[model samples]
Target: MSAELDLSPEVPEPTLLESLLYNGFFLGAIVQLLCILAVIKPTSNWYEQV
Candidate 1:
């Protein structure tokens, strides 16, 4: 029946802070990787001056 079809499982949405923290953690990880790469590759002009 149509009603039975409509009863498919639904996933809950993340809370605002939970979403922000999840995304923010990846952003921070990317930033840390760039910092480490800059330190390891100082010959590149992009990282050398700063």
Candidate 2:
């Protein structure tokens, strides 16, 4: 029974570097999305003005 339990694989936890990279990527995506919206907003306003 102990041998069978030992045979089970343990789940790996995320390291500090991995967590930082993951959060960085998430924030980068949000900033990029906001930038895209900003660019589109000006264009939309310009179109309305015409």
Candidate 3:
């Protein structure tokens, strides 16, 4: 009888470039939400001309 085990595997760690790309997408989403809110409401409306 013969048995063998494979202890090593070919896998790559995340590089800096890959990490930055991931964060960019996340940050963009938050910024977009803020922009939408700004368009829908105003902080003050004291200049209503009748």
The digit string of per-residue lDDT tens for model 3 on 1-50 reads 27887779968988999999899889999999899988988657767743
For model 2, residues 1-50, the per-residue Cα lDDT tens digits are 45544667788999999999999999999999999998877654567687
TM-score to native of every candidate shown: 0.64, 0.64, 0.59
Return the lDDT, model 2, position 19: 97
Report how far off residue 20 is in candidate 1 (Å).
Answer: 0.4
By TM-score, the better pick of 2 and 3 is 2
Runs in model 3 lying further than 4 Å from the true structure = 1-11, 46-50
lDDT of 1 by residue, 4-41 (tens): 55666788999999999999999999999999998988
Model 1 lDDT-worst window of ten: 1-10
Model 2 residue 50 lDDT?
75
Clashing pairs in 3: none
All candidates' lDDT scores?
0.88, 0.87, 0.85
Candidate 1's C-alpha runs over 4 A off are 1-9, 44-50
2 against 3, candidate with superior lDDT = 2
Estimate the TM-score for candidate 2: 0.64
